[model samples]
Each structure stands twice: as C-alpha cells, then as structure tokens.
Target: MNKQGTFVAVATSILAMAAAGSASAAESGKFQIKAFATKVAVDGAITKVKVDQLRLPAGADTRAKDAWVPTVAAEYFFSPRVSVETICCVTQHDVRGSGPLNGAALVDNAEVIPATVTVKYHFPLSSGVKPYVGAGPAYFMVFGEKVGASARALGATKVGLSSELGAALQAGVDIPLPGKAVGLSIDVKRYFVDTTAQFRAGDRVVLETKHKLDPWVASAGVAWRF
Candidate 1:
C-alpha cells in the first residue's frame, strides 16, 4: 500500500483499540495511551545564499512555501503527573526564488519526516480535567527531493537539503468523558528547526542558503488509560 493508505490503516487500528479498552481505562491505571490527529503549519525564514563567501545582493529573495499535513502521537505515563510521548508526521514543501532569480522554481514536493520525543508534566487540577506542558527534541529526515522543471531547464543539476535537529514545546489540556474511560485532548506545539538548502549543477553549486522552519502543530483527539 502507499504511504497514505498505511497512515489511514494505522489510525483506524488505534481508534479501534482505544474504543475497546475504554471500558477499563477511565479509572487511571499505570499506563495511559492517547491517540491524536493533528494539523501542522509551517512558518519559515530563508537566509540569502553566499557565493564564494560573498552574500547575494538585496534582491535575491529566496523563500520556502508553507505546508500543511496530518500527524499522530502516543503517550506513555509512568506516573500520575509525568509521562513520555512521541509524535511523527510527513510533509512536502515548494521552493521558490525572486529578486535576482525571479521566476526560479527550485524544488517541488520535497518530503520531510519529523520524529519527536518529549517528557511531559501533568498538573493535578481535578479528577476529570488535567493541564500539561512538555518539551523535547525533534529529528527531521528529508528525502524525495526533485529539482523543479524550471530549475532543471536552467541547467541546474539537483536539489539537496540537509536533515536537521530541533526542539519542541507543547501545552494542552485533557477533559475526561463524564462516566466513560475515554477522554479528549487538545494541544499545540512549536518546533524550532533549521536546515541548509543546496542547488547544484554538475560539479558547481548554484545557490546555497539556510532556512529556519518553525512550525506550529495543533492537535485534538481521544485517549484511553489502562
């Protein structure tokens, strides 16, 4: 199956398990499993490329377009107030250029997969409601790179982007169902990631620059504790 199909299958299985375990999950046990569906939006800043140690003129405006994607996460609680969680997602972006390089389409649909691990602390507010905060590290793996047709036509060789390491911060709240073992959760996270983008042809580098990709991920879903 394709990636989209696999993602759907995994999500279905998770929801099924949560439903089945909800009967025994409400009282709060040693393990708490939460499944979430989230949307990620990217806000990025691109620095100008330097050729032979000389920065480009003021007009070389290189930029990366924003992207939106779905993501999933799971949490494992070791204590009533402390837990560990991991989140993952894949996304694609478009690269563009202006000013000196007007009409330059550098890359299209480039893929990036981000995996994040975090430690969370849940506040003891009341039995049915909880608020939490978390912080962690994120690793980004980039692939499926393709040089845009416009760039290829301009004698550009290929597009290369370096994978990056970043950090994330999260804050959210959880509200349990009145009499069921199920609960609803809502959270938002900010990721600070930076990477280098390279455009090369033959043995020479055409353009190179740094990009700061700080995306905000907002999620809401269900959980079952057992």
Candidate 2:
C-alpha cells in the first residue's frame, strides 16, 4: 500500500482493536520494562541549502543509512489504561550524497540519541491483548559526526549536526504471557525531526544545509510488568 493508505490502515486497526476490547479492563501493572531489538530507518534528505561556499553540484541531496540497535523502555502506569513511557538507545548513521552527488559520502559515523517521552492509552481486550497509541515530545541529540572521506577530499575539515527537538507518534500491541507479568510486545514510532549540517574547512564554514531526519523506529521484544 501507499504511505497514506498504510497509515489509514494502521489507524483503522487501532480503533478496531480498541472497540473490540472496550469491555475488558487492562491488566494490573504499575510498572513495566521492555527490552527490544530495534531498527531505525532515516530520511536524511537535504531540505534547504543555507550556505554553499564549496559550490555544490546542482540538485545535490543526501541520504542517511539505516541502523539496527538494541533499545529499552520503562513505563509507569497511572491507571490500568493510562501510562507514561520513555525509551533509551543510541543509533548510528552515515550520510551519503544523492541525486547529483550520488555515491559520494558526506558525513560519517554520526551518533544520535533520541530521548522520548510519551503518554499512552492502552485498549484492553478480553483475550488479554493490549493495543495502544501514543504521542509525545522528543529531543534528538547528535554527536560524534565526522566529515566523510569525500568531503575531506574537498578540503572539508570538520562536520557537525545540530541537536533539535521534535515529536513522535507511536502505535503498538502487547500480548500477555501465561504468567501475566511477562508479555510480548511489538511497536512502531515515527519521529518528526530535522537537523542542520555544517561542514567546515579550516576555520571557515564551507557548507550549511538543513536536513529532515524523520525516522521510523520499529521494535519487537519481551516486556515485564510489576
């Protein structure tokens, strides 16, 4: 399905699940922790050029490589159906040239920590399945950004990515285990964020560009409630 269609389907499924389970109360869990295998899919496309002293090629664009990482989440339940959650992990990516600058590496080995907090509403089902949707704020901290080999060949000395604040939309489901304290969880989150990339040659800034780093984070894992 197309992107819009996929999103629509997801929304419909969440609503349907909520409706189907509306008659049941959520499981008793004041605290929950999850350990996840996560994937970070990024769109590092350059959105605007603020400075271009190095004379970039026409139609120059960029893309960030996707990464797989381990993540953990901690959540506190205010009520059976309402909870607050935060996740922790660091994802690494490399930015490469696209369009006119295809095949050229622009940024290397950048690490980003996406600190997020969300308030989630869980829909309980008769079969003990809980589906949820959440929205919240996120702060993206970018660090350890290095200029790529290609950029260095062009006299670039240093590279930096600015940290930015953004928001996230989340959807997920949890299936209770026989013990009720442990469960299986699957989750998906979309982060709406951006960053400014600056390349420096000696003491002078050679290039500055705005990039959209909207990433889709997907995870599946084991969850424990206490």
All models: lDDT? 0.72, 0.89
The residue-by-residue lDDT of candidate 1 on 10-82, one tens digit each, is 4455334444544434434356566777666765457545542223456666566666666667778655666
Model 2: residues with Cα > 4 Å off, grouped in runs: 1-29
Candidate 1 residue-wise lDDT at 213: 74
Model 1, clash count?
Answer: 0
| Residue-pair clashes, model 2 | 0
Which stretches of model 1 miss by more than 4 angstroms?
A: 1-29, 52-57, 98-104
Best-fitting candidate, scored by TM-score: 2
TM-score per candidate, in order? 0.76, 0.88
lDDT, model 1, position 152: 83
